[model samples]
Target: MAKSAKTKTEVVAETPVPKKTRKKTEPVEDLTIAEAPIQLQAVENYSRFSEFDIYLFKSGKHFKLYEKLGSHVAEYKGVIGTYFAVWAPNAHYVSVIGNFNGWERGSHPLSSRWDGSGIWEGFVPNIGRGEVYKYFIKSMNNGLELEKSDPFALWCEVAPQTASVVWDTWYEWQDEGWMRNRRKHNSLTSPISVYEVHLASWMRDPDNPERFLNYREIADSLVPYVKEMGFTHVELMPIMEAPYPPSWGYQITGYFSCASRMGNPQDLMYLIERLHLEDIGVYMDWVPSHFPGDAHGLYNFDGTHLYEHADPRKGYHPDWKSYIFNYGRNEVRSFLVSNAVFWMDRYHTDGLRVDAVASMLYLDYSRKHGEWIPNEFGGRENLEAISLMKEMNEAVFKDFPDAQTIAEESTAFPGVSRPTYLGGLGFGMKWMMGWMNDTLKYFEKDPMFRRWHQDQITFSLVYAFSENFMLPLSHDEVVYGKGSLIGKMPGDEWQRFANLRLLFTYMYTHPGTKLLFMGGEFAQAREWNFQQSLDWHLLNQAPHKGIQECVKALNSALRNQPALHDYNFSPEGFEWIDSQDRDNCIVAYSRKGLNPSDTIVVVLNMTPVPQQGYRIGVPSVGIWEEVFNSDNPSFYGSGVSNTQVIETQPEKWHNQPQSVVLTLPPLAGIILKKSAK
Candidate 1:
C-alpha cells in the first residue's frame, strides 16, 4: 500500500505487460433505470440536462441572445421620435453611423455587455426623430465588420441606396371627428365595387409619362370621377417606395415610407383626406408578404442577416426571389406591426387590402416537393406565418376599430376573416377571388355556353357566409397577359359593351363588396400597364363617355335606393330567381331587405335572338315597374326596353297575382321595381 503510488508510476514505466492481467476494457452499457443506481443516476441527470437543452433550443434561446445584445442602443419614442436598437451578439464595439450622425461611426459608439448568453445593449438618446442612422459593429469573435440600419426604423431614407426617412413626427388629423361620425353609419355590404388604380399610371401626362402629378393634382382630377362612378371604395396599388419602375409597387423597398417618387408623405395623406372629403373610401394595396430583392434595401440591410433569418429555408421567398421577414422573431414582428400602424395612423386610409395572403399562409408556398420541411408534428407548417398574419390583423383592428383589412387569398382557407382570438385570421373582409374568376369566366362565355356557367355566378352564394367578401376586378386581373375586362367578352363591340354593362350591373348588385379597375367605367380599351398612362383620352369619345355616364347613374341609383344600401351587407340580400336558362339566355334576380315594400328585380338577356312574351318567374306577381334598362338609348345602346318608372304588380304564382308578360330584347337587362303601396 505504501509503495502503490510510486510503484504504479514505476511499474508502468519498467514492467512488461502481462497478457492475462490485461483485462479487455469492457464497452459501457447504455444505462437503464433498472441498472446500477450510480450509472442510472448519471443517465437520469444526462436525460434531464438533455431535455433542458432541447427546451432552450426550440424556445430560441440562441436567437434571444442575439436580441439581448442589441437592446442597449439609444431609443426614441414619440409621435415623431425615432426608436433605435441594434443586434450585435459578438460585437466588441458598436457605433451609430448615419446622416444624422454625419455618417460617422466612432463618435457615438454603442456600449455593449455580454449577458452571459452573448447579448449587448446601450441606449442612444435623441437619435431617432427623422435621423437616418446605421450601426457600425466590430465583432469580438473574428473582427468581422458590419454596418446595419435600424431594423425597426420607422423611416429609412437613403438616397439611391436605402430610402428610409425618420417619420416620427406627428400630424394633426382635422378629420378625426368626421372619421368617428362616418364609422357610426358604415355598413359591411357585399359587392364592394372597388375601383383599383395606380395613382402614377391612372393619370400621368400622356405627353410625359414620367411627369406625374402631385397628390393634389390627382385628387383634383380623380375624386369627382370616382365619386360619380358609384364606386364604394378606391383601391390604390402600393404607394410605398419601390425600386423597379414597372413593379407596380409590388417590389416594396420601403415598408413605412410612402413612395417618395409619387410625392411627399404629406401628399399621400392629403390624397386620402381629399378622398374622405368626397365621401369615397380609400383602400391601400399593402404588400407585407415579402421585400424587394435589392441589397441596399430591406433585404439584409444590416450587412448580416438581421431582418431576414440566416437560413435560406426560412428567409427566402423562392417564388418572388424576395427576402422573407422572420415572422417568428420578435423584433421583426415589431417592425412589421409598427409599419402597419404607421399607415393607418398617419395616412388615415379607410382600409387596407392585404396582397398575396395565400403566399404568406404556407411555409412551402409556391415550392416544389422535397424543397421544404414539415413542422415538428409532421403536418404542413403554416403555424408561424399564419400566427403573424393573425397578429397583424388583430393589431390593425384594435388600433383602428373602424378601418377594414381585406385579404387577397385565392385559397379557400377557413376563417380567414374571423376574429384572431377565435383561432382564425382577423380580417374585416376577403377578396372574393373565386367569385371574380367564376363570374368573369361565366360572362366571357357565349350565350350557348352560359347555361353551363350560370352556376358559377349563383353557386358562389353557398360559401358567401364564410367571410364578408369584396367582388374585386383587381389590378391583377386586368394587366399583363390578362386582357382588359371588356376584351374578355365573346362578341362584337356593341355586344361587348352590352356584356360589360351587364357585368357592372351584376357586380354592383351581387352579394359582395365591389371593386373596379381604373378606367374600367369607360371600358378602357387597353390592358393596364404600369409604365403607361390610362387611356383618359378614351373619355373624349361618345361610346366611352356614355359608359362613364351610365356608371355615374348607376352610382347615383345605388346611393338613392335604400334597397341597394340596406341589405348590401347581408348574404340574404342577393337571391337568384333564374339560373338555369340556356336558350334565349335570361337570368333574373331580386335584391331584397333594403326596402321590403319596394323590391328590385334585375333581368339580363345575353342571347342575340330576341324572345317574345318571355315569362320570367317573379318572386311575387305584382305590377312590376321597369326601373333600369341597360339598353336605354340614353346609355348608348338600342332602346329596346322600358323607361325608369316604378312598376306595380300583384302576386300571381304561388298565391301571387301580378306578373308582367313582356318581350325580352337581345343583349338587354331590365331592373323592375315592385311597390307594395
Candidate 2:
C-alpha cells in the first residue's frame, strides 16, 4: 500500500526522433506524367508514394496518407516540383491553382486514378515553398466548383486569408535528451501539473496591446513562466488552423496545420521544441467531434455531405452550430487517425486532449427528444463514433505508447481511460468534470451551509480511481459571467482569498493529475476575455499577490512530495481520517506513497471559525512537522498557523493508533509529515 496517496509509451522507431535526412519510401502518383502533353517534361522523382498506399487507404488504415494527399515539394526525376493530391471521391475534376499557376483552374489539372480510388494527383514543375495553393474541385454530384484549402497542409496563410501554403515541416530538434526520457516524466507515478494556456490571450505586446505574440516570442516568455510555476506540461487550446478568433481555436478547419494566427508550421515546431527542452511536455486540444460549417472548410465538400452525415439530425451540432464528422466512413476515419498521428510524428507533441468527447459518444447529447437519430441498436450511443474513437486511441498508443490520449468526456461513459482490448475507450486519462463541477459548486456556497453539502466534497473518492483522471480548473469555469475562481467564493476579500487557497490546496492533495487554466493562478479579477490579455497588473495587489504566492507554494509542495502524487489513481494512496466531520465543515485525510515513511496528513477547515484543538489521526508515531500552512502571512493570510513541530499522542483518535491535536486555521488547509527520527 502506498501509505497511500497517488500520473505522461510503445512505438519505438515510430516515435518520430528527428534526423538530418529522411529515406524515400515509395513513389506517389504524378498527374503531370500521366496527363501532360508529350512535349511537356514531367518531374519523374515527384512520385512520392506507391499503389500500396492506395491499397491501404482503400481499407481505411492508411495512417500516413498525409504524405501523399497534400501538396509537397520534392525532386521527381531531375526537376523539383510541388506534388499535389486530394481525396475527392465524388469530384468530377480537381485542379491545383494558386499564385503559382495564376489562379487558373485549367492551368494545372489533376488526373483521376484509374483504379477508382477517388484520389486525384498531379505535380507542377518550378513550384516550391512559400507559394500559396488551393484545390479547385468540381463536384461530381452538383457540378458546382469550390475552392478548398489542403486538409494536410503543414502551414497556411494567416487568417483572414484562407489559402494553403506549400511549406515544409523540417525542424532540427535539440530536445533529444528530453524526448528519449519523457516516459519518466509523463508516467502515472509522476506529478502532472498542467498549465492550460491560450496562446493569443496568455500575453500580448504591452506596448501595442493588440498584436498577438508569435510562437517564438511566446517560447521566450510563456515557456519560462510555466517552468517557474513548476508546471510539468503546457496544454494549449486548439492551435489548429482556425479562422474564427472567438471560437478560441475549437472550431477548426485544418487539423494538420497549426493556426496561422500564431506563426507558420515550423514556428509551432519551434514552440514545442522549446517547451520540451525546458522539461515541460506539450499537449494540444484536438477537436474531432465536430467541424465548423465554413464554406471554405469541410462542410458540403464536393457539393455534398462528403465529410459529414447525410442526415441533419445526425450530422449537425446544435450547440456549436457545426457539422459532425462521418466517423463511419473509412476515408474519414483514415483522415482523422492520420491527423492524430501527424502531430506526434511531425511536431513531436506529447499528447492530445480530445475535445467534446461526450458529444461524440452520445448521439443525443445537447439534443431535444426528437433532434437525434438513434444508432442501429436503437440506443443513445453513437456506434460509429465509438468505433472510430477506439481505433484512433489504438493507433495513437500503438505508434507511441508513452504518448497520452485524454478524453474531455462528461458522461458516465465507463472505461474511457481503459485500454480498448479491455472493452474501454483506450484513453490514457479522462477529465474529472464531475469532480470539478461538484467541488466548485460546494466551494461557491457560504461555509455556514457547507455542512449540508458534505457529500459534494467526499463523493469523489467513491469513484476517483475508476479512470485515470485529470482535475481541471479550466478556462470554461471563468468565462461569460461565470466569474473568476476567487470571485465565486461568498465572503469579504480576505475570506475569498482564504477559500480559493483552501480550494487549490484540496485539489492538489486529491487523487488525479492537475490542470489550471491561465489567470486562475493569481485570481484575475475580470472574467477571461478572449479579446484582451489578463489583468497582470493585479499581481501588485496584496490579496491577488497572495493568491499567486499560495499557488507557487502549493505547487512547490506538490512537486517535491512523493506521497501527494505517486499513488493518486489507487485507493491505497488515500484514506479518509474523518470524512464525516460535516458539523465543523472540516475533512482530514492521509496520502501515502510506495515507501512506508512517505506519508502526509492533510486537514481542511472550510468555516470562518478556526479549530484550535482539531484532533486528527496519524499513521506514524513521531513529531509531525508542519511542512506547509496555507494560512501563513506570506500568502496574504492573518498569520494563523501552527508551530513548526508537534509530537503525536499515544491515545487512539479517529480510529488510529496515534493522534495529534493541531490548530486548523479558518478557511485554510495544512500539510504535515513525520520528521526525521
Candidate 3:
C-alpha cells in the first residue's frame, strides 16, 4: 500500500486508531456487494452501519461511501421516507430540520451509532423528494448551534436561496452507443478540440436580457453549434451550486449537486445525453481545491472545523477567500473520491478537468514565507492533497477507463499527468499554461519588435511533450482585465484580425489537443461577462464572420487529417524545417502520421510583408498542394495565396534533399500536403 498523507502527529478523529489500524484492511471483507446503494421505500430501521463499512471508510479506500452516508430514499416496512446520515464527530447532538417538520429540530432527532464511527443516522417515514432540509447541530466544543446544508446534496435551490432538495436519479438515457465506443473518442491520439463554455453566460434570451437558458435549452442551442463547428468535445465551467454568481461557480457550496439555476439534475442529464449522441464528449470543470466560507456551507460542521483545519494558515485560501479541505482526514478523501466517480457513473461524463490543482499540490501557494506550513518531509508539497488526487484519478480510471482526469496546474510539478503506480500523480492530461503564455506574449508584441524575441514562440517545443498537454485559450485568459484574445494583439483593426487568424492556425497545427473558450471562434471584441450573453451579433460583420469560418475550417481539418492528430503526444510527429529564420520572422515545420506518406508542411509569416519564392524543404521531391491557406478571402486576409501547385526542386535545403519555392502570405499560416499521385 502507498503511504497515507495523515501525519504521525496529527489526529483528526476524536480518538486515535485502534489495534486494527496496523492490520491490513481485512474488516472491509465482511461487507458484501448486496449492502451497497439499494434505495429503500418503507419505514426502514437501517439506523446503524456495519463496522466493516465504517472501517473501510476510515481507511479512505471506500469509493462508494456516498450511497451509505448521504440521503437515500427507500421503502422499508411499507413506509417511504429518506434516510439521512452525516459525519459530525464533535457535535453533542444532531437533528434533521426541514419544511416537513416546520423547521423543528426535535421532529427528526438522529442517534449516534455505538460503533465509534462518528456518524449519525435516522429515517423519516412518509417524507420524500423536493423537501428542503438542513442539519441542525449543537456543538459539544462551544455550544454554538449551526444549521448547515447537506454536503452531498443532489439538487440545490438557485443562488441566494440555500436549501438541499431530495433528487432522484431518474433520467432514461439514450446514449448506449456513445458509452460503448467512448474509448475511440477519448484516446490520446483522438482529435480533442474542446469548446469551453459557462452555461449562464453562454447565451440568454435576446429579448428578456436577464433570463439564462436552462440545460434543455442549451442542448438545443449549444449542442448543434459545437457539432457544426466540428469540435469533438465541450468542456463546461463548473456547474456546481454556489451562493455567489461572480465567483463563476468556483465558490462551491454543494459539491455533489449540479447548479439548480439551470434546472434539476435530470435536465443536466438530458443535456449530456444529447451531447453524447452527437458524438461530442463532455468534460466538467471539477473544483476540489477550496470552497468558500459561506455560513451555510462546509466552512464549519459540528462547530469544530470538522471539514477544514482549525488553523487559519492551513485551512484558509487567501486568494479566493475560501477554506481548504483537510485532506489528511480519511472521510474527506472518501467524500472527494466518491464525488469524482459519482459524476462518471451517474452522468456518463467523459472527463473531469480538475481546477486549481497548483493550489492543492503546494502548501505555500500564494502565501508569504512565514505564513504557511511544510509537509512531514519539510517540503512545500502537500502530500495529503497529492494522495487525494491520486485516489480520485485511480478510482475514476479503474472503473471507467474511457473517462479521464485533467489537471489545471500551472507550476512545474513533475509527473502531474503520469499514472499513480509509477510514483506519479494519476492524471490523463494537463493544461499547457506555459505555451499559452509564451505564444500570447509573442503575438502581443509589435511586428517590428517580434523578430527580436523569436525565441519566445519557439521555446515551447523544448518540453512540449513533458505531459499529455492540452493547449487551452480558456475562460481564464478572457476575463478579469486580461481582455479578449483579439483585443490583446498589438495592431490596427485589420492587422489584429489577421493576427488572430494566424494564432488559431498555429494553435491547431501545434502538437497537442486544443480548447477554445466561448466567443473566441467568432472574435468577440468584448471580454466575457458572466452576467451577460456572448456578443453573438458580431457574426454579422465580415471580419468576425471570417474568423468564425476559419475556426470551422480548422476544426474540420484537425479531425480529418490523420497526420495532425495521430501522433499528438510523441515528439517524433513534429520536425522543424526552418526555425532559426528570425530575420524575416517566419517559422516552418512538418507534421507526420504513422506512414511516411502522411505528411503536412506548415509555414507561418508573422510580419505584414509577404514573401514570394521562399524555399521550404520537404521529405519527398514531388508536387505539394496548398491544402489550407489562412490568407484566403474567406478569412478576411490580404488574399495573397498559392492557388496552383509547385514542384519540389532537387537542391538540398533545411536538412532535406528536396525543396519547394512558395508564396508566403503576410500574417498567415498555410498547410501543404504531399500530392496524391
- TM-score-best of 1 and 2: 2
Model 3 lDDT per residue over 1-677, tens place: 00221221122233321111111111111224223343454443555356688998788887777677767777766777888888887877777877677676555767666656778777777776666777887787898788888898887767676867766666678999999999999999999899999999999977888998889998999999999999999998998898899999898999889988888777899999999999999999999998988888988878988788778788999998889999999988888898899888888999999999999999999999999999998999999999999889889999999887889999999999889998879999999999999999999999999889999999988999889999999999999999999999878998999999999999999999999999999998988999999999999999999999999999998998888999998898999899999999999999999888889999999999999989988889889998889988988888898876789999999999899999999999999998988
Clashes of each: 53, 24, 10
What stretches of model 2 exceed 4 Å from their correct place? 1-45
* TM-score between model 2 and native: 0.93
lDDT per model vs. reference: 0.65, 0.85, 0.86
Per-residue error for 375 in candidate 3, Å, reads: 1.3
Superposed Cα deviation of residue 160, candidate 3 (Å): 1.3
lDDT of 2 by residue, 591-617 (tens): 998887889999999998998877888
lDDT of 2 at 338: 96
Between candidates 2 and 3, the one scoring higher on lDDT is: 3
Better of 1 and 3 by TM-score: 3
lDDT of 1 by residue, 485-521 (tens): 8888878888888788777777766666667778788
Q: Candidates sorted by lDDT, descending order?
A: 3, 2, 1
What is the C-alpha local distance difference test score of candidate 3? 0.86
Q: Model 3 misses residue 543 by how many Å?
A: 0.6
